[model samples]
Target chain A: MRRVVITGAGTINALGRDVATTLEAMREGRCGISDLKMRDLERLAIRIGGQVHDYVPEDRWNRQQIALYDRFTQFALIAAEEAIQQSGLSFTGKLAARSGVVLGTAGGGLSTSDENYRTVYEEGKNRVHPFIVPKLMNNAAASHVSMEHNLKGPTFTVATACASSNHAMGQAFHMIRSGMSDVMLTGGSEAMLCFGGLKAWEGLRVMSKDACRPFSLNRNGMVQGEGAAMFVFEDYDHAKARGAEILAEVIGFAMTSDAADIVMPSKQGAARAIQGAMTDAQLNSDDVGYINAHGTGTAANDKTECAAVADVFGHHADDLMISSTKSMHGHLIGGTGAVELLACIMALRDGVIAPTIGYEEPDPECALDVVPNEARDAKVDVVLSNAFAFGGLNAVLALRKFA
Target chain B: MTVRDKVIAIIAEQAVLEPSDVTGDSSLEDLGIDSMGLVESIFAIEEAFDISVPFNANDPSESDFDISSVDAIVAAVEKLKAEQA
Candidate 1:
């Protein structure tokens, strides 16, 4: 099997607009959850979120590009620009044909959908925008990335709720391992922090009213976040031959469905994915030193995730450092796993474990060694990133430090 | 109808069984009602009784809603409806 490696990564989340600033924020335990700045705030029950601040699309894109690209797609393109530039890959000839883009997004073009819907219904407008369909489609980000990079190979989108990015990246890793594509422009983007997005989630009542406190005793629910994280995943041999810098090696990936409930998470299903990822990576439970948890801070997800990890790792669960970056970045939903993967990279590459911020009192149910409230320096060779979606879809990825 | 009868009827409707077939101690798992059916059963009970159930599917033990048997569910729902009234 061809080994898959990460060549470059870029992100624009609540933490920072670029990789360097974001990683630095993680190292320092910066909390990005703030009062959401959008119209119709009175209508929303949960108004706080981790929104990307001070993003001026006009600085990077023209007026025409701005009109064509929604907030989510603009984020994808911006992150992709940094990632591809860092990768230094110019697609032409066979390389162009062998490379493609696969992105994950739970709510693609949500801002576009919200704007057009408000225009039609609330404002008494007869007709919506002309490009509404093209702009609001779920595959808009993947399509735009393919067009911009001239990736003629297989291109598609994955929309498996919160696990979208992990499922998409898992598929991309499979393609590279199976010799389908030499490189994949993979990761995800989401802009679900708009009015309609918050309104819909408010109905579910899983949103935190105050702050995101994962694995904490008084935690109410999850806080919604918006942004994108894009990565360049290349074949390891291909990356080494070109002398490109390797970020981290993608060792293994696994996905499992709970087949239990739509909203409730299943412990058995999550455990299966975690154990499966370790088996696929050929790493024992003791070999893993850290984990980026899918700790959404909701009453259901945090405890259930802890139970799953304990079941899978057994005694080693106590030794390994586990943290939920969602406590800092708020839950990014589909784009979350990709951003959480950045934490795993930071753990293995820089010997830093990002802490679960906003943690005050720990719950007895979630008694794992949660690196609470502060970042820690730890030399970990292997790390696992977990993403469990709303529909009980679980995707776990195992990464190793490139020796 | 009594709360027992109504709850049994809802569970039976989900399991494709008659109220007579659903015993007080019959488990939903035995009736072949999957997790989705269980959720739907809870929703129907909530709507019918106009009371919220403290059911957490992640850890059922942590919730107030009991799932050991039909009798347990009926008792919990009755208790909730009484408290609401």
Candidate 2:
């Protein structure tokens, strides 16, 4: 099996418009959750969300294309553009045909749905927008990304709720490992900060009232965030042969389904994913220096995830630096795992662990070195990124510093 | 004021436009009212008149009742109110 390594990564979240700014904010323990300023959100029960405020549609897209593409796909295009630029891998070569794109998204073009619903309901108009179907589908983001970059190999979107991006990355890893594709653009995008999107989450009743405080005793619920993160993954030898800048090698990946509950998270599922990844990587628990937790600041997710970490790492769990980037970026839902994976890769390369902001008064159940509220400088050799979704879908990816 | 005036007022308020901007024959799209705004307006109409609007966006033209224009909205609201009474 060929080894898979990330050559470049890009992200746009509530924290910042690009990867460098976002990572710098994370290192400084910044929180992006703020008062919601979206249209007609004043009357809603949940008024706060991690909205991407600076994003504007590129001039390259026509008016019709703009109308058809959702905010999530717009984010994906921008991030993928940056990733492709940074990877320095030109598709002009033989890499064009062998490359693919696999994106993850839970709520795609929902904002468009919200808009279409209003046009029909309040107006009593029979003339529906022509771009409704193209705008609202989950696969639209991946399709747009592929169209933008002309990636010919296996292109699709993975929809595993919160674990969507991790699943996408895991699939990309396997594809490269199996020699099915030489390069793949993979990640997730989510733009569920709209009024209708928040209303749907309100029905679930797990949204936080104040700021998100992951693993904190006073943590209320998860905060929804919107963003996209993408990575250019290529085979180790393929990248090295082309003199590509290798960011981090993906050693192993595993995904597990918790046939347990629809909304409730499970420790068994989380532990199995971590263990499975470790086994696949042929590494011991002690080899993992840091863990990017799936801490959604909700009570169930934090406790269950902590227990899973303890179960997988045992005594080493206490010493391991565990943190949730969600505390800063808010929960990106489908895009969470993809952005969190970047944090892992950066930590492995930079030797600085990003802080889990809003970690105050940690619950005894979640007693780990959450790297509380302040970034720590350490020599991180191996890192693990975990994502557990609503349906007990758990995915984990293990990455090691490229030797 | 007539029901037509009240309906125009409601549409104007809900769509965040001037009352004069919403003519009796004006399309909702021309008034800058999207689907989400339409839903909000429906909720507002329900609360204001204390009558349920048995309408679905998916099946907007199912009933003889329609709300495309100020006159139609007022007529629909009045008919629904009379039925409840």
The best candidate by lDDT is 1
> A1-403 in candidate 1: lDDT tens per residue?
9999999898999999988888999989999999999898987767899998778889988977777899999989888888999999988889989999999999999899899988888898999757888888888888899899888899999999999999999999999999999999999899999998998886564677788889998777899888889899999989999999999999999999999888889999999999999999999999999999999988888899999999998998999989999988889899999998899999989999999999999799999988999999999999999999988999999999998
Compute the DockQ of candidate 2.
Answer: 0.02
TM-scores of the models, in the order given: 0.85, 0.82
What lDDT is obtained when candidate 1 is compared to the true structure?
0.90
Candidate 2 lDDT tens digits, A1-403? 9989999888899988788998889889998888887877875677888888756686558887798788998889888988999998767556778898999999988888887888899778888878789888999999988888888889999999999999999999999999999999999999999888898886555677678888887787888999999999999998899898989999999999999887778899999999999999998989999999998987778999999999989999988999998988888999999888878977988888989888779689889999999999999899999999988899999999987
Query: How good is the docking of model 1, as DockQ?
Result: 0.12
Worst 10 residues of 2 chain A by lDDT: A202-211
Which ranges of candidate 2 are over 4 A from the true structure? A58-60, B1-85
TM-score attained by chain A of model 1: 0.99
